[model samples]
Target chain A: MDSQSIATTPEELDRSVLPHAHEHPAFLRHHFEDVGQQREAASFGMWVFLLTEVMFFGGLFCAYLIFRNWYHPAFVAGSNTLDITLGTTNTAVLICSSFTMAMAVYSAEIRRRGQLILFLVLTIVLGSAFLGIKAVEYHQKYVDHHIPGLDFSIQEFVHPSNPKAIPLAPDMAEKTQLYFFLYFAMTGMHALHMIIGIALLFIMVARASKGAYTEGHVIPVENFGLYWHFVDIVWIFLFPLLYLISRYR
Target chain B: MTEKTQETHQDAEVHVVKPPVYLAIFLALLALTALTTGISFIDLGVFNAVIALAIACFKASLVVLFFMHLHYSSRLLKLTVAAGIFTFLLLISLTMTDYISRAWGMF
Candidate 1:
């Protein structure tokens, strides 16, 4: 009975005279005091990295704000050229992926290996769906000759393709290129981040299948969840700004 | 009982958000997305952009607080995020002052 009760104890007391001996799990780094401390340090580091990402994306946002204000009419014309249906669909897809990622982190915390794998797979699928829709939108833009510096035509903006469409002067129509330039810059950067994230998700899924995160080492999954959600937040703002601007016109 | 209490103590340090809360936040995000899109189809003049940005900001807050676990994080981490936001605002506002003043009274 004594042996069974002692075996049930969370930790085994070592005979070493040192205070820290045998108290921490193997996963705890030598530099850390305990598992809790290690987790805190890891999370703090991830937050710092995410803050840098914020500033990196912030620069693009600042430029976009200035250009949009300077050329409001062109900004409206450029924004209207985008397909709202696809934009909204992509937004919902990204949000779904974020939800799956959050669930994956939860699964790891609860040590459910199957659920973790399932959620991760779901997230990857949703992320790919977002990119696929993005590709379609880009293809449409290519066909419409909206791409800046490559076969861009200001004819449509200057001539008002639709009878009710408001026409812009040739000089102002030229500014539409700046709007599209910012559009490509912002969304292209966002897509590049998503591509990197999807690549990392593949590596994580491989490791997770082997039970890497379900064994009390959930920091990696949790940190990646933060990243996935951060990407989604970027799109949340992008959707309304790039697609919804002057849609009522 | 002792082991259970110890486990609880460890869990208290880093709160594990449950599935229900995640689902709630997810639904709320979807609903808000739809709301923003629908509202955009109505002409609100400058308020259209204002309302859209307001909704986007709220949605971002939901993700940051819950998905990023900032709400349950230590004070130090929360302060770090706050500082980042403050710097971002400062960058935008400071630059705008120069731009707006350069064209002062020209419009």
Candidate 2:
């Protein structure tokens, strides 16, 4: 190595150093005038990405609302079959993940590499926990034959395990299949987002290990934090709408 | 370069005190989440939807203001985001209008 290319101390690599400097090729973008501009543009771009996601999920929500109103009785019965405990737990887990993701961004800002990594890992773990619980719930639905395909069985609703249980008419029970279809579609989409977020967290962890964000360019971490929180927010809406409505009935 | 030009350029990159406010907004978000969930168990009839949506809007506002840093951003960026959401809302509302009005015809 040339003497002019000596390694600089961490303290010497402060925020005043232009983030657009050629130290990291991956961090620079041709369209951006500087690192700040690059970061701002990237964050704005992410918001636009999230807007599209909202619209994507928004379609499912519209379908759900329509079917829900058209067959209110069946929708209520369908909601009652969901295990509220599991759904509520998943909601809490997702919120905790959002909290940790926010802390990860804050740690990056404060230049605490260890804390940033810790929170990022915590966020990933919490997210996985949510998906795990959701899997179990889905499995239970499968065993009960509530899955919304042609294989779905209406026996559970017509022949209630408890004599006092609400006996849905065959037509209403069939409409329940529509409710389950929307449920799986919406929650499945949300879970897909969680998986993608976890994958990105892995990439962020690798970059963070190289002190990318710790060097004061924390905007990547921050922008990713926003995306994670937006995903969490979508689930927050989904949980109540899909799993909690008329659950006590 | 003229002194006025230099001053204006310097002001462009001014580092505002945004971090603390962002943290406070984060705390507000946590509180709002808890509040919304707690209220959901109550029998609010049709008002539950209104309340839930209201709280969600409040939470979304906090995220947009603090985490997304819209409060510190330029007017152009703000308009860009607003336009996107407005367009989305328009789509949702118009589509729902068609579906919701169909209910009366079915009766």
For residue A127, what is the lDDT in candidate 1?
92
Can you tell me the DockQ of model 1?
0.52
- Give a tens-digit lDDT track for model 1, residues A1-249: 001211111232222223564654445566765567667777888888888888888888888888888888888888888889899999999999999999999999998889998999999999999999999999998998999999999988998666756799999999999998989988999999899898988988877777667767787888889889999999998899999867735
The superposed Cα distance between candidate 1 and the true structure at residue B97, in angstroms, equals: 1.1
- Candidate with top lDDT is 1
Best by DockQ: 1
lDDT of 1 by residue, B1-107 (tens): 26764564465387899999999999999999999999999889989999999999999999999988999887777988999889888988998888888966522
Q: lDDT (0-100) at residue A53 of candidate 1?
A: 86
Which ten residues in a row are the worst by lDDT in model 2 chain A? A1-10
Error of 2 at A65 (Å): 1.3
- The residue-level lDDT of candidate 2 at A49 comes to 83
Query: Top model by TM-score, which number?
Result: 1
